[model samples]
Target chain A: MAHVVGPEVVKYACTCGLLKSISSLYFCRYCCQLRCGFCVCHEVDSHFCGKCCENLPSSEARLKKNRCGNCYICPSCQQELSTRIGSKGPSNPEDPKSTPKKMYYLSCLYCRWSSRDVGIPDQSAATGGWPDRENVNANRLQEIIEMYKAMVLAEKQQKEKDKKKQRGKYLSYTDRTGVTAAALRKRIGLPVDIQHSLLKAKPKEPEPAIAKEDVEDLPEELLTKPVNLTEVTTIEQRLLQIDLQPTTVEKLFPVHKQLSIKRSLRCRSCEHNVSKPEYNPNSVKFKIQLFAYYHVPEIRIVTVEPLRAGRPSELIIKFTNPTQHQTTITILSLVLSGDENEVKEETGDQPSLPQEKQPPSLSSQPSSLLSLSSRQPSITIKPRPVSQEVNADVAIPSSKVILPPRDDAAEYDDSGDTHNIQDDPKLVVWRKSNKAFVKLLVTPKQGLALNTEIVAGFTMQHIYTNTIATTVENREPDKHDHNIRVFLTLGNLVGFD
Target chain B: MSRNSIKILQGALVCEESKLRGDITIGTGTIIHPSATILAEAGPIIIGDCCLIEEQVKIIHRLPFDQQDKENTPVLIIGSHNVFEVDCHVEAPKIGNYNVFESKSFVGNKVTVTNGCIIGAGCKVTQEQILKENVIIYGHDCHMREGLDRPGLQTLQMETLSKMLPNYHHIRKPNKKN
Candidate 1:
């Protein structure tokens, strides 16, 4: 019988194949390979002070003359020098604070000798905390200003050139350009000298207008024929009553796209990079920084339905999760406001009907496997007030559910999978708790029609209570009455109906 | 705007040939000039309120930086009663009053000179550097660069002055005029 043995399989072909933990793998800086410390050449960059790294913001770091403002490069070995607290060790004993307490890796690019071997002291190491440079000279300062001025002048000249080029493209649109030029000059408050140059009369050009037949003609069906939306209208009519049911009105349209990670390589000499290198392919063990927008699942319902009897109506929302995973949800109070509807309905307004979407049914598994949990964990959240007004849609996952993976998905273990979809249909159940009463009364006028023209738009929880006079003769019952209540489910909510 | 006028874009004052009051201290290297008005109505113009203002050489506080947006308005605080000599300009300080300005001083944009400090003649303070209270500055444009590349050559002259006047301290008293 032919031996069915695989050709001499390597036992420890990359610790990746072995049963070893991730920590055992050593990162190689130069080769960008992950070895078990035995496979590849490991080179260390400059050692930086831990304290400085923690304190400095990224913006400030980029502005520094050196790539690192606090950490210094070792002039002798080209290796990073480690900073140590207290006097003693390889630093000046006279200056007690200048010493290396811990051993950090450094590489000599020329010799390929790591800091582990040659004990050469790096000059870039912070021996005395901070260095004092001499004061700036007045002449150099003036030169910097002059250079900045020249750069600004060059930028202005380039903008002018671009404007002239744009003008060349549409020479026949001289009248429009004249108007735009006048408007721009007025808006920017340009002085008289520039205005004179701008408003100078130029020769006008007349161009032949294209006939209707010259333009690209569309199909007759696409042009004047109307779409037969009877099916949509009937479905919309059937669902109109369901919209009247009280529910949370928080709705948002999320433009969902895949969260992908891109890796790039950066050179120490020039802070710029040629291409993004793969993180997994590189043996460089960089500190992974993860930023996430963690939300506390909550729902809100806003309505304009006036409460005449000094009583608030209850809001009822139903959400169904199609996925088998159990999720958490929270209910939040809603803000209600009143406003007039000024949007006029177009004659051929074929209200787009929503396609019948199926609810995700739960598996036949026992309910004992899942339990209710808080949407937000009991962690203190310090609300950092943003200086500007922001319109942001935050997805608040339940404490039980997981947050979705971001672009840099490798950084975080976002195990919650349901959140990555538009309809992870959650069943949110809540009751209206506000007791604020609002009153609306319509008084008639002499010159107007017998009945006042009243229109109303409502959401899932909001009910339109517009007073209608029975005297209006030419009103269609289906069109004049409130047609539908819109149900909006936000990403942050658990269940929505 | 002209280059010189552009320099005054970020809340700078030019005394425009005026006198400054006393008891105000300014940050190091502020510039104020002639053809400026600094009238501290109520509070003294205290430079270096937040250490952001640079070069309060001959600056005065006729109006506050915030209140300068008001139309046809005269500011109440010309902090520290600070005065400027020829080519001395006055702009509003951050907060706190006390003016102490002296002759031929040129304060730059965004300069802060605190209360109880005196600025002396021909001084040109450019960038944002603090001048503490009771800090007395003397000489012309004390800020001078000390490097190999001296493009403008004016920095070299300033450096010479810095060397000539070696003794510098927060509490150093002004040397008597020769």
Candidate 2:
């Protein structure tokens, strides 16, 4: 099962108009809509070292520039470097009783790059104490960043002063108090004007970089000497040391391994988490996973006859109800124009889905009001029209096929079929506990060239039972007919037989 | 040609599990780990002193195709203090002292390794060329660079393995005294 590759024969349309397979789509239970990766918001959940699997906090990771402290990568090949011990001979060759001293150096097992290759001295201990090189222009860059931050703060303060002056024209606080702020400051024996003093003590500005007209010429050796490509570093090697892109291979230094991140996805409209991974980096379990495969009806291509141009082909697709509730599947015609209108209406009706807050009851306590006031309004994204085009026509089935609820025990008890339910012989070819194979006649459009790819689309309407208990008095589950657009890529068209 | 053809000099440790074939002369103070293969297909192989050959290392001395018909079979001489790391395939015609062949590094018979050279792990040197002294071959592209100093010797590991291997595995008796 792990080796089985999925052939993208069926695709479901996402709410954001992106077509994706069911395995890639997520069903947001709060919004009760399908969301693809494009429509969801992704956030980094954790930062971890890929080599050691040590989880680092975001603050510590940021301080270390998002690199593992203990792990070092090869300067030449960027592979992980292992610590190797080298034994040095005794100081005096005549002293046969003396033991050799052990020295450790970082070495890459893959690329054979060792600290000794670049003239780096070996350390007495194994784990750390390797010297780290500081960027040459770090102090200059830090000063520039500080200067920009002060300048932006000064501009923001000026904007606020202008706004205050504008508001003062309507009603001045000095006029209402019958005294100016200067008088109050004078009475308190403080500085009369605070703005002037504060402005005079502004942060020092950094010197701007000046571009010179005269550029340095190329070295004399470059014109005379034959270039050795092996001695020069490639562009990729230079970029590995971002600060100083060394052109020569001698300047290469071991880089700290960068930390990896785990991501969590959230539905944009409902502000609900669609997928949230566990905090532990080693654990692959997720806290919340609302995949479409667990909520929507999965459709797989069973068999399809050879599609000929302008000829009808028998396309059999198996549909399985993944939800616990029994559902009735209705196959509707591919109404492109009608779907556009329905999407527009749903976008317009999204605001009305959230129920209005009821008036405060007479017996309500003050704490309840605090909770109600803290609730934030959910943001909804406008739905877009699906962009898929149907090239082949599907003959809609008149009768609706009903699927039973999934039962785990029924899989083990594979005795002769019981609880018989009559099904349409022409529509449903086979039926099991919760799976049904339906047959459809698909006709390729005429005038299509030979070997042209044929695509057929249909609207699948299934009964969805929302098990969420609302504030209403009734405890009954809310059942509504949900419609989804499904597209099937039939085989290429064949020439006339 | 025969099991007795292996010539182990004095103080050399040759494990019984090591596969030695044809006329092979192991120098003094050398340590041959178990499972290391030293095959002399066309001629004799003379390995120098203080060399460490680890497990799964293959050192084959086969004549080149163009030189196979020559009446004189040149001896493949590996210099002193050369280290053959685990799982490395070395078929170079000549190797100098203080050269380290890292794990899984393949040195074809067409190449010649000089003194103080280090072959990066998994590097394949098939181009017919001679590597200069203190030349280091590293990275995916087999980038070459000259080292400032020679790599440190594995004297401690050799000493430990020499004492430990003789206790667990059968050792070939040295054919010549020091």
Candidate 3:
């Protein structure tokens, strides 16, 4: 647990070839592979305010520009402002029954900044109605937006007309013969018109802004007065009020707090959600979380002997089984990314994958499930190759360790191991209810310099007991071997004594 | 340097477990918690009224190395309504009213603190300069800003701590009468 602040000694290579801690990696039960944030598709599930926890619909969020209307942050320090109650003295000094009026003003506790500094008047009641400054350029901006909308609408109509012309099987009344429209009008005994309504219709473009050459010169007072840093607002304070980046302190205003969103991650291969958060903003639980820490055997480096080049050193690591099913763990030789062609081919160039792997036949799933959640096809990002180098060699033991099922009551039950399970004395150093410490030998390469960091890698194969009911008929859950690449970063080599 | 002379005026609550050495004067209604150290190596410290010195705070009055042989003993005078939060080290020569030295903050001997000044948590002020009134040094970048008013007083916190600390800890009696 100290590794939260200390160095990360153990890292698991994601199926996408990125090395991440097991806690950050997710296990897709349907795909039966480890997925990381890089490989998973992250989508916004809901938007909510961090302070008030008020959820906003996507349309409303877009309308409000993704900022919480009620909550404001201090422009000076970026901390949330607290509304302070100030009491004005009773209107009548002689009347004892009169209550003093309460006025509310936003104040920053950290920097002691308040709305009064910028000359904003205090409100009588708290929630809102503090005057919002109208944007000076709002009208012009609205006109420009309307002009663009009209132009785009006209373009779309022209495109549709062209499409209709292309769809026509025969020539039209004008295009078929060599007769002009003016001649046709004369033949019909009517006055010939010069312009056609459709031909003359066009959207008027707005006048473009012209570049000015003149620049304002510095004021004469700048030479005589000492520069006061306090009067001028810092870059951060100015940027907080994005629309109007005020240069002076008096122009600084409180900014509305931006909204936060919950994200749902889906696996690309099987198109199943790997992690989905609960909709409620206050609840910390997740609706569906297939984290690898719950499914895979977590490895932690316990201790390692001081390193010397070409000398064998003992390295002890602890493994914990988080699931309820007993599983067997085996250590195998590491296979680099390029060497595994089958794994690479399936994950990459999968745009037209007709037959999805791992899930019970895709046709067997309900049709409504597919139509209800149909969305635009997600773009697949290819994983990069693992770039970590292994400087040390690990002695892969032939024996396998059997981890017992996790029992909550066994924590208090002092009566130790009644179950008869065979253990390798050389490998198993210590064993608890569901945890075991395994020992191994590591040898750094001979050419390594002093103080060079040693890295050892291996592939771990564990029997994963799937608990998901894949089918109604098959009562027994499937058991399969899941392979994971484990890399350990041993400390720097001290010397070659 | 080994002399232990402490003068706690009336209404001042100075804990007996606090490490007080040399000549130190606590003003009326000032509260000093247990394990707070005030070492007067080169001079006496005069703490003013209603100041709060929390646990693990170290206020040392050691002069610079070059001025060790000077004849005059420099007096470290702290002003009223100040707050020295947990683990703050103040070696500053002068302190003014309504200033706050937040937790884990350090003030070097060269810097002078003034009224309504706040040294943010974990901020270190080692530069030699006089702090302006209401100047707040905040964040890891040590951003500076002038506040409109002094930060709210810790009257409620001090009232609760005063009532709570004596129940569990030993209090040093005030010998000096106001």
Which structure among the candidates has the greatest TM-score?
A: 3
Segments of candidate 2 deviating more than 4 angstroms: A1-7, A87-102, A155-203, A335-382, A403-421, A430-434, A469-477, B1-178
Number of the candidate with higher DockQ, 1 or 3: 3
Ranked candidates, highest lDDT first: 3, 2, 1
What DockQ does each listed candidate score? 0.00, 0.34, 0.52
Please provide, for model 1 over A1-497, each residue's C-alpha lDDT reduced to its tens digit, 9 standing for 90 to 100.
01221121101112112211222333222111123333222222222233243222222222232245444333222234444322227546577667555433433222122332333333344433332333245355545544555555556567987775333311221123233444455568875223333332331222334567577767687568875331122222233223232121111011111112223332211112223322331234434211000111111233323221212222322222211222322322211221112011111111221111100011111342342122111222121211221111122323222222222342353453333323222422221111111121211122332222322112212111112122245242111111112112211211112
Could you give the TM-score of chain B for each candidate, in order? 0.36, 0.96, 0.97
TM-scores of the candidates are 0.17, 0.69, 0.87
lDDT agreement with native, every candidate: 0.30, 0.80, 0.82
Best by lDDT: 3
Where's the lowest-lDDT run of ten residues in candidate 3 chain B? B143-152
* Better structure of 2 and 3 per DockQ: 3
Cα RMSDs of all predictions?
36.8, 9.7, 10.1
Clashes of each: 102, 0, 0
Which of the predicted structures, 2 or 3, would earn the higher lDDT when compared with the native? 3
